[model samples]
Target: MTGPVVVGVDGSSACMAAAWWAAREAVDRHAPLHLVHSWTSQPLDVPISQDAHSERLYGREVLRRTEAELLHRHGDLAVTTDLVAAPAAQALLARGGDAELLVLGSRGHGSVAGFLLGSTALRVVGLTRCPAVVVRADDPTVGAGRDRLVAADRDEVVVGVPEPGPAAEALLEFAFATADAHGDLLRAVTVVPGSPGPRAEEERRAWLAAELAPWREKYPKVTVAERVAVGPAAQLLLTSCGRSRLLIVGRRPHPSHLVWKLGPVAHAAVRHAACPVAVVPHG
Candidate 1:
């Protein structure tokens, strides 16, 4: 981690939740917290409105109040606030330059004012230079849902490893670290394309175990659960991920693509998963 954890704020409930989540992440990573609110004085197509100045001032006030509340809750944590004069997504992308990780709400109240992560967040996450974690609107608070995995007594980190190759190394490492940090179990899953025979299932199980062997030794405290399901990747993950604290998936970094490069499974997880989704870019 090279820089602070940057979270986008828009005075919406979702944005506040994301900020709270980012604060906890900053604590975990031992990094500073930056609360940012991006605003544009001039609209892309329309001319500047008479109330543009007041709107900008309101953005600053939102940042100020958000900063204060976070400080009140975490007095010892180093925090900073910024008001960027750029489009929401553009400002966030620029801020990510100095961020170790960027956190945002999955969806916001709207695009004009509240930090709605809907389109802007998707755009930022698609083109982000740093890893972006999307916190759902209804995510449970730290005091309420930190370790609350559905139907499970202990928290479990679920990672979707599409393949047992280098592409998944980053995903596995993140999952293992997260699980170890929470003293939880790590569940590594790979969804096959179609129904698998008993022999194929056995082979996949073996392969999953082999791929995760080194990770298991590296984090002895982390219990590793391996699974190979036969079905569409997205469906399998959405079905099994309900019992995990966090669902992590990998994306191939392709700056030249000019569009979001998340595969089907990752895209689905982000859109539907019940827990926080971390999209780790790997080679």
Candidate 2:
């Protein structure tokens, strides 16, 4: 990872917030920091295209200047810039490959996701190569509200099948840490595909209880619940994730799998969860 903090920037106020947070994080982690920006080529020969194209170029230049200033401000830190020809989420995931962690502004350049957890953040959180931190948009004074971290990282025991794969472990660890640190409630949630058969629901419920039982010592106060309903994971989770301090999920084993990439549960959590969502890498 070259021991550097990697942050994705889109020249948005949110991105800058992420960059600022990343600077502090790099200092804390004693690692270098890199600021990344992305832009695609505009349509060929269109009116005002020059202005639009030039704007991204300016953004890149500004990023360079800021990178230098950040390094200068931090006595022993290093900062660099990356310009890429991909979407913000894709670039961040790729860049995250060489980072201890990835920092992101909870909100994106445009289109807020209920709060700042818009689609980009959601997609990237579960897919990033490393654990991701979504800096809250409000930046409310630390130790605000419930001041709790909800850990929802775990395999969704599929009745007879194991929780998707090894990915759940990373997610659970992030959740456990946050909960332990923030003194927040650790709400472990899993979705069970809707089954009309009462027998199937009963079996799934039993399995969830047993799975969560072993983690009691780890989370003395974690509340466990399962939603056995129809529809995709994302929609169900979005509807159920109420007041969670941080909705946690893990990277599925097969990052390239289309279903895992756009899983209903993870997508919904990223898109609509009120609080920040942490995408934990495979621990």
Candidate 3:
């Protein structure tokens, strides 16, 4: 949390929404907000005319306008802007290396469809060392009229708790910290593969409680609820998002020889969750 919160801006409604979200998060963390826009020259192989100078100007304008709007909404917030001459994904990664968090917006196809993450956002989320949050552009909660920057009293921060290990520990650390920051309830959920008997169910619940004990001690003021369900992990987590202000899931680094990939649960949550989703890489 040493650096400012960085958000990618492309002059789209989606990026604007993400900028707003990032502003609130920055305020909560007592950090600055940085808006970044990247532009690149067209490949020589393409026949279409492309003006690198014009594109650079447009990128600067986008950053300036976005910075103005965010400062308007959050007058006291420390805001900065950058125009990078590189591809979107590359620029974001380089800027986000020391950031507290990287925020991006995902477009929704329609009411029935979930998020449609663009290539830049997907790649950044997969590879970023810091936590990446994907905010839906069409989220009703985000807008100019919203007066409250903090989460509601009843809102909860839901985190998908994987098997007990380093990954789960990292995920819960973020979830508890966020919930404590906003004074929201923390809900930790785990979904097993198959239906279990009464004894097994009891055992699972006990295990979940044991897993959360240390976190509870660490954040004694933060209230926590543990839930254990039997079903697909992604579906259950997505269902929980309706009541959650933020949904968190964990992603493990891919093998050295292969490209980084988002695990099944993290991928599904970012794509379909009703609330803003944070993907944290651990282990």
Candidate 4:
């Protein structure tokens, strides 16, 4: 919470949606908002309909309009803009390093308009130490969470706990804090080994209960539902998220290579879930 909430902005409606979501989050956290747009110029003398200059101009316009709109929406919120001449991933990673949260918009398949969750978002989310939230551009519940952050209509926050390890600490803390902030129900789901014997099932349940007991006591006001599912981790999580407004998952920051970024379940949730996904990085 020390640094401002930063959002990556391109001209795409998806980035706009991300900016709006980031703005609301900034307001909620009482942090400043930074809008970043990164671009690299085309080769000099390249023949094109819309050249680098035009693209730069358009980027500038995007920033201006987005800044204005955010200000209009939240007059008292501190909003700033930047147009960087760099790759989107590098710019976002650098900016997000010192940010409270980094928000980016995801477009599936890149067929329709809007910024797709191309390499840039995936890279930034994978490498950044800060918490990142990927908001789908086509999400129907676009600004609903912002409208009622404390009391959203669908007030269930679902988090997937893969196993008993130190990595889960950050993810669980984020889930609990989010649920507490919104005064929502917290649903923690863990996938037990399929067809476990009764003793193993009891042990798994006990471990889960013990794992969450500290958080439960700390957040006494938070209503929690602990679910132990036996199936493929991703499928069970996706099914459990039917009534959830937000899905929280954890990913370790791996080498910048594409293959090392998201774990299987987190990747699946980010790719297929209808709700927004908050990917918390844990070492």
Top candidate on lDDT is 3
- Candidate achieving higher TM-score, 1 or 4: 4
Report every candidate's CA lDDT.
0.73, 0.56, 0.77, 0.75
Give me the displacement of residue 278 in model 1, in angstroms. Answer: 1.1
- Per residue, candidate 2 scores C-alpha lDDT tens digits across 134-212 of 6554432112222211224321111111263455455565565555544455655555655646786677667656665
Q: What order do candidates take by TM-score, descending?
A: 3, 4, 1, 2
**Model 1 deviation from native, Cα RMSD in Å:** 4.3
State the RMSD for candidate 3: 3.9
Each prediction's TM-score versus the true structure:
0.84, 0.56, 0.89, 0.86
- Please give, for residues 33-80, the per-residue lDDT of candidate 1 as tens digits: 998887663223323456878778877887898888777767788998
Specify the highest-TM-score model's number. 3
Q: Candidate 3, residues 1-283: lDDT per residue as tens digits?
A: 4689998877766777788889988988889998887656222222333777787877788788888877887899999888877777777778778998998876653221111135546777888888998887776446543475434533789999988798889999999988988778899998664667777778878888988998899999899988888888899887776668799999997766136667888888877887788999888
lDDT for predicted candidate 1 compared with the true structure: 0.73
Q: Give the least accurate 10-residue stretch of model 3, judged by summed lDDT.
A: 109-118
Per-residue lDDT tens digits for candidate 4, residues 58-147, read 678878988998887799999888898887777777887788888887764332123324555676667777888887766644653236
- Tell me which of candidates 3 and 4 scores higher on TM-score: 3
| Angstrom error at residue 11, model 3 | 0.6
